[model samples]
Target: MIPIRSAGPADVPVILSLVRELAAFEREPDAVTATEAMLADALFATPPAAEALIAERDGEVAGFALFFHNFSTWTGRRGLYLEDLYVTPAARGAGVGTALLRHLAGIAVDRGCARFEWSVLDWNADAIAFYRAMGAVGMEEWTVQRVDGAALTRLAGR
Candidate 1:
């Protein structure tokens, strides 16, 4: 069985490393600006902004999934939003990813989540296929919108 557990303060460095790896895999190696301290605060602060699950293989850190809760007005319940899911190259196709996803789904169910959702890059065909195989359907009509950095500040008229 793939050993999966909740990440703790000690796991911040590994989590950041995995996040960098994921960024590189997504073709944005330089996009990551998060530091260990920032991650620790966001993840371990009173009322954590997010939660993470670490997947281990061969007694080593193999992958991680970071996520948080989002409210769903339509469902009148919270939904689990997966921020990132990454499996080490060596551990790919070894059921690690599947196990992590299953664990998250179980958490969503146990927490009475209205839905479990995440977004994938449009070019990531392999990941899209994998998610579909896992019974996830695409929300073709919905387009995600975001405003961040300077633009976010400008929007707030700050």
Candidate 2:
């Protein structure tokens, strides 16, 4: 069984490295702006904004899953939202990704989450297939919208 555990302060550096690897794998090698300090604060701060799980294979770090909770007014309960899941190239086909996903699903069930959800890049057929194989269905009716950087500042009237 792949060992999955909660990430601690000591795992900050490795987690950041894995995040960079994920960014590169997503074809955005220069998109990562997260630093160890930023990650640590986000993961370990008072009422942490997010949480991370570390998966290990053969006593080595295999991948990580970073997630957070969101409220669903419709369901009147919280939902689990996976922000990122990355399994190293070497660990790709070794069930590491499956194990991490299964772990998160269990967490969602244990926490009474109304739903467990995440978005995958359309170009990543492999990931799409993987998620489909795990019983995930695409919400074709919904399209995600985002506003950040200068636009966010302007929207906030700052």
Candidate 3:
């Protein structure tokens, strides 16, 4: 059985490695720019920016889920926003990913979160199918918008 546990500062290196592996799996090997220090700061700070869960199978690290809390104005409540959910290729069929997600769902419920949400890349058919099978619906009418780097700086007049 896969066991899920909360990650601590000491797990930063493992988390970074998993993040890099996940980036490669998503066909963007060079996309992950986060370092172990960055992860430790964000996840273990006094007021942590996020939290993580590690999945293990028989003492082997199999996957991880990184998530944060988000506010929903309409609902007037907090929600859990999953930033990343990844299972190592070697452990894909061992139910590690599902266990991690289910663990997070329980956390959300216990914390009184209004919703549990995440984004899946459009081209990842396998991930899409997996989420759908778990009763997660795609918000087809909604579009995600972002502004970063130069655009964000310019917008802030910085």
Give Cα-based local distance difference scores for all models: 0.98, 0.97, 0.93
Give the per-residue Cα lDDT of candidate 3 at 151: 100
Candidate 3 lDDT by residue in tens digits, 49-128 = 99999999879888999999999999999999999998988899889978988899999999999999999999999999
Q: After superposition, which runs of candidate 3 have C-alpha atoms over 4 Å from their true positions? A: none
> Across residues 1-158, which tens digit of lDDT does each residue of candidate 2 receive?
99999999999999999999999989999999999999999999999999999999999999999999999999999999999999999999999999999999999999999999999999999999999999999998999999999999999999
**For every model in order, what is the number of clashing pairs?**
0, 0, 0
Q: Please give the lDDT score at residue 48 for candidate 2.
A: 100
- What is the TM-score of candidate 2? 0.98
Global CA lDDT of candidate 1, please?
0.98
In lDDT terms, how accurate is model 2?
0.97
RMSD in Å for model 3: 0.8
Worst ten-residue run, lDDT, model 2? 18-27
Better of 2 and 3 by TM-score: 2
